[model samples]
Target: MDLYFMGTNAGVPSLERNVTSLALRLLDERRSFWLFDCGEGTQHQILRSPLKLSKLENVFITHLHGDHLFGLPGLISSRAYQGGDTPLTIYGPQGLKRYITTVLELSESRINYKMDIVEHDGGTVFEDESFRVEAALLDHRIPSYGYRIIEKDQPGKLDTALLKKYGISPGPLYGKLKRGESVQAPNDKTVHAAEVLGKSKKGRIVTILGDTRPCPAALELAKDADVLVHESTFLHELAGIAHTYHHSTARQAAEAAKYAGVKELFLTHFSSRYKNNEQMDRIQQEAEAIFKDTTLAVEHVLYPVDR
Candidate 1:
């Protein structure tokens, strides 16, 4: 899977970056994309990138802040205009449905597709054969949430060479062996699947956090994640200000990633105050001091999460 940063700035849009928005591209896995946040002017950002609004299957709003959700109506309308007939589901906190519907109604926007809203309290919000999404309440000013996306383990490939040794040619029998089912040989001998298949592939874990201060829930959700996407709205020196605003500093975000034992930590939701690369590097340096695998999110950049 890959994560594309559409907008990485916090609160407002700057010349260098827009507000909070990220697209988890799952074209190879699910043939669609899952959007994390739709900040204002997010649609415009997508236009400048390789992302497609029609490929978006779900939108997960982190909080009810205007900067985090103001572009929902516009995006939905544009998706309809682009001939996206497939249904879309949005998962978020309470009042999300009202917010989207109200804006659509007031603007007289007509959508040709179905839309479903899910307001989850906590725990597993969505589950299927391939993946499961769990939500946890974050320590933000509002009822913000963080999502832990767990991909189910995949079965290993069949050992063609081993099967050939058993006088089995590649065909329907290989499919059965790959499914861990015992198949009968041409001589009526029972062939066990385990002896002909490789080890199962481990699943990938990704945790995306909303605006929040360092808290236990964040750490719990981020544990053992392949990628931990946390907000770093301030530097280490301005940690007190970050606490006052209920946001995290680079150091605090790094602390969470280190405690959680994540493989990679991506710091996003940059405060607009850091305008130049020098200022941004300082924030990244703070996080790297604690967690060496830390990266600062840049707009239009795609970060891959591979197992």
Candidate 2:
């Protein structure tokens, strides 16, 4: 799995960064992509990347903030125009359904595909054989949320050499073996799948949070995650401002990553104050002081979520 940060700025668009939107590309795992936020100008940002809006399946909105959701109607409309026929699902707070419905109705936008809008009140929002997603209410000015995506453990590859040694030719039976099923050969020989399979591969965990103060829910959502994407909207000197705005400082984001014991931490939702690369480097350095693995999320950069 990979994470592509479409827009990384905190509130408004700056010369260097846009608002808040992230695409979680699951091509290798699910053959589709899941969006975190669709900030204003988000479609423009995606136009510059390798991502295809046609392959988008789900959008998770953190709150009803304009900066985080203004692009929804435009994207949904564009998806229909771009020949996106597959169904799409959106999960967010209570007002999400009304917001999306109102905009689509007012704009007279008719999407060809089915749109499922889930207004969540926390807990598990989605689950399938491959992944499970849970949401937690975060401490913010509005009813913002944090999501934890857990990928299911996959079965290891089947031992081809072992099958060959048993004089078994590869076929549909190999698939059953890989799934840890026992099969009987035509000669009445019972082949145990587990005996010819390698160890199972562990799944990856990723946590993405919306704008919020340092809260217990953030830590719980990020616990033991492979990568935690949290907002660092301000620097240490302006921590008071961050608190007053119900936002997080660079140090506060790192502290949450450290407490959760995440393998890597990506700090995003940068304040507009950090304009140039040098200024952005300062935010990374300050966060590194607390969690050494912290990294700043550069727009359009694809980060690998490895196990």
Per TM-score, the best of the predicted structures is 2
User: Scored by Cα lDDT, where does model 2 land?
Assistant: 0.92
Q: Which residues of candidate 2, in runs, are more than 4 Å off?
A: 164-172
Please give, for residues 1-307, the per-residue lDDT of candidate 2 as tens digits: 9999999998899988899999999999988999999999998888898888889999999998999999999999999777689999999999999999999999898889999999999999999989999999999999999999999999988888878877677899888887789987666788998788899999999999999999999999999999999999999899999999999999999999999999999999999988987988889999998899988998888899878
Candidate 2, residue 23: the lDDT equals 94
Once fitted onto the true fold, the runs of candidate 1 whose alpha carbons sit more than 4 angstroms away are 161-176
Estimate the TM-score of every prediction.
0.95, 0.96
TM-score of 2: 0.96
Error of 1 at 250 (Å): 0.3
Give the TM-score (vs. native) of candidate 1: 0.95
Backbone collisions counted per model: 0, 0
**In candidate 1, which residue pairs get closer than 3 Å at backbone N, Cα or C atoms, i.e. clash?**
none
